[model samples]
Target: MAKQFENNMEECFSTSKGVFYLKSLSLEDNGSVSQVIKKRIEAINDENQESEEGDAFFVADIGVIKRQHKKWKTVLPRIEPFYAVKSNPEPLVLKTLANLGTGFDCASKDEIQRILDLSVDPSRIVFAQTTKQISFLRHAQKHKVKLMTFDNEDELYKIKHKYPGAELLLRIQTDKIKGSVNFGMKFGASLDSTKPLLQLAKALGLNIIGVSYHAGCLIAEPRAYRDALEHARSVFDEAKELGYDMNLVDVGGGFPATMEAGITFEVIASRLSQAVDDMFPKDVRVIAEPGRFYSTNAFTLCTQIISRRVVSTEGDSDPTFMYYINDGIFGSFRTLDFGYIHPVLKVLRKNQEIQDDWSGEKVYTSSIWGPTCSPDDFVAKETKLPKLESGDWIIWEKMGSYTSPASSEFNGIPKPKVYFTET
Candidate 1:
């Protein structure tokens, strides 16, 4: 099935009806929205015509990844992005980032080894996880992957004994944003505890080179970036007083892939650029660990509606329709737990033929589910969608990041195979 999807991409194959040039379609082309969707549906049907793989797959646009990198450079030109490997660790995504010269933010020994296998420089990888397994530390040392992070005093002792020569960044706790992923809870040292930790690192003769902090993932406000930068500056000042030549300050990952209305990347970048200029020196190299910002908008998910149910509702409201899709929360949607992500869904018109079910008062209140037997397998709840039937397909956008890498082949439902494209 994976091979067939790959072949379809290479052959630029489409159904006998016509070619659907979705690769060339832009988001701004609202006029071609239906045409693009029709093309995607055709592409999926053409590839999975005889497959028992349940007709669910992901389409990755390498162009979208490239465009995001360009946008990052255009916005915050100073800060280099270390693509978080945990986001979507698809081999293609990693290869695309490596080709773009983006660094990686790895968490486990496995992630580090994988990036290193790509012939990526050890310096281009940061073991961002503050918690260290001694064996993993030794593995990093053995591979010469030196840069890592530490927060608590116990981690200092572990690193002191396991990999004393490793260059370190003190991951400090930042202001917790309401409704954002509170990374500080698990990682980050308190501002008050940073000095003691740095003193301990000094006492142990360990190499503490700089500081890092995660504002929060899916930051709701741009002010979080500015505030986190300001907090990082204070840590830098303290590091200077402690006689450490802090050359870097990781303004950790909190960037969004696609911005909400009125809160644009331009606003965030402008704030970040100004903060970096004000807080740090010209020679000090600044970098970021941006996960979703680089990967989220790069892939599209195509799922077939396997089954559905209609249940009663109160008043004149349309009945609640349940849609069973091949993929679920356990699959590519594990990241949905972090924030309120409402995937923009479109019902694909097959062979450029509009379905009668999708037209005329078909806006039904619906919920989409995954194939797993677990009741927790809900994908989207309370979605207003056109009435759909079994085998009808839907496209979920902004699904590239935190989707595949986190998926599991649980309940005997295989992971969604991906089709990579330059378009």
Candidate 2:
């Protein structure tokens, strides 16, 4: 399972499959891409993989995966990544996730078709559609993907008419999170509606084995999860009342991934673990769809400065500069407009430390604009960097998950490469 890579100006780039730009490196004189990466790793003395757990890439950090993934924990924590393929469906990413032994949570036929091309097993995928295309239902059935979701009767009927022998789960509608930006607006059928959805499934002889919900992304309160438990309890209670048995409870993907602030994993995990002990049904199998949590910090995107624009003000004003980069919204940092910050660090320039208070200081401001021809190419609307020149590399760490999976070459820009690490 070795991969081929590409080099731009001698720096090494590692995409999941072939060469990528984000993992780009700056090469020494007369160096090739592969050599550049090896040299960089050797210099850092962090390139060696000791144990599977300590390595950056490995299958699930769970045991068997280590052997299969070799030192990559054979794919890097095959946590059933249920990869939000819509985020960035580059074959490299899918193959990487698949190699890790993860199942997918596909939403559309095109997405399913794409994964199918790569030979992903139908059983390793869950067609999680709240709204599904009727034709795709038969494809899902024909393909042997046994699991799916719904919050309404229409979805139930569509699946019933197309593939009635399917297994199903009712999408539990989570309440509005106080300050949620993305997930609060869409999805869900209330506690009452869930009853009928479940009943509808029973009526059609659809195997209703589970119940699911999304607390929405970046939920602030541990209580939000705690509160959702109550909703789930009510749903589970209804199933029992209707003489139905549910074997699974899917706490769908709302495990927050860096919306600047939210409950930490240690805290949330502790709380949920306690709740499961006290409340979760004795016979239920617990499954979580965590698209962001595991992969959020797994990788980073490195973009070089293609150009720098300096903005200067008058009347004792400080000099502000913008470093337009080769990657932008197309690279999936568009959430910045909604205050999503991925924590930027300068990769090549080691001496400059990001300042805590540069308000009064002469701050050199710059914007890392993506390579799109559109005026909206800026990824970070206002970026503060040291006096940097063109070609200096900027590292946006923990960007592996949503970044590439959601990127687009709007201006025909070639997607950047992805490099994995066991360091």
Indicate the TM-score of model 2.
Answer: 0.75
Would you give me the overall lDDT of model 1? 0.77
Give lDDT tens digits, candidate 1, residues 1-423. Answer: 224333224223232222323233234222332344455456546765555545577767777789989999999899999999888777667767887999999998888977886778999988899998888889899998898999999999999888888999999888565325677777798889989998999999999888898877656677778788787788888888999989988888867776753466778889989989988998888989988888777777878898989998678566888999988888877668766344666665344354324556558788999999989999888877876787888778888777877788788777877655664
lDDT of 1 at 97: 85
RMSD in Å for all candidates: 6.2, 8.4
lDDT of each: 0.77, 0.60
Q: Could you tell me every candidate's TM-score relative to the true structure? A: 0.87, 0.75
